[model samples]
Target: MPVRTAVPADLDALVALELRAFTGDRLSRAQYRRHLVSPHAAVLVADAADEGLLGSALVFFRKGSTLARLYSIATAPAARGRGIGADLLAAAEQAARRRGSRALRLEVRVDNAAAIGLYERAGYRRIGLYAGYYQDGADAWRYEKPLAVP
Candidate 1:
């Protein structure tokens, strides 16, 4: 398995993985494309030598000083349970820290226990909650991890 910075060439694979991982969610391909082209955004891909994209993580920088917000993270169905998600997350954190980010943050649906577990194990702490944050009216739990000691 190899972890690398996602390039425009990986757009198609990233989009496909987004659709699969977001099954019930509704973000269009155009939106995904726009994100890929955003100046403050980045996507990391985990590829298997013989296969292809195994996992992907999209991180966005909101207006402010050095803070990265992980928008969406997905691992190909066949690639789950193998630490691919963890690897992608570690890559994202490393990139953010290199970019001088002060912290990393993300919001996950309250019902997404699996992801919540992953985040917790990754050193993210639940900071707060947002009611009805998802289109489906699901509550979201905000998680954060400091990139540097304050």
Candidate 2:
């Protein structure tokens, strides 16, 4: 598996992966295409040796600050449990650090225990909660991890 910066051509596959990971509230092909062209966004793709675009991470830069916000991360259903998510996250963090970000932050659905676990394992700490953060009225757990040295 390889982790690399996403290109506009990868939008279709990313949309497919997003649909696979989240059965509800999926991003359309148009949204992904726009994401690829966004100036403040850094998207990474995880590609397999045989298959392509196994996973993706979309990181958006916070305005007027050195912080990178993880907007979304999803791995293909068939690619789950294979560390692809981990790889994509690592890439995102590294890219954020390279761009002078002091920390990485994101909100995970409170009901998504598995994703919370993954974020915890990746060194994020739950800093707060947001009520009704999701489209379906689900709450969110905000997590943050420092990217710079003490």
Give candidate 1's error at residue 150 in angstroms. Answer: 13
Clashing pairs in model 2, backbone N/Cα/C closer than 3 A: none
Q: What TM value does model 2 have? A: 0.93
lDDT of 1 by residue, 69-108 (tens): 9887888887788998899898888878877788999999
- Which residue runs does candidate 2 get wrong by more than 4 Å? none
TM-score of 1: 0.90
10 residues in a row with least lDDT, candidate 1: 23-32
Candidate 1 regions with alpha-carbon error over 4 angstroms:
none
For model 2, give the RMSD to the true fold. 1.6
lDDT of 2 by residue, 31-85 (tens): 7887788878888999876898899998988668898899888888887899988
Q: What is the Cα-based lDDT of residue 68 in candidate 1?
A: 92
Query: What's the lDDT for residue 49 in model 1?
Result: 75
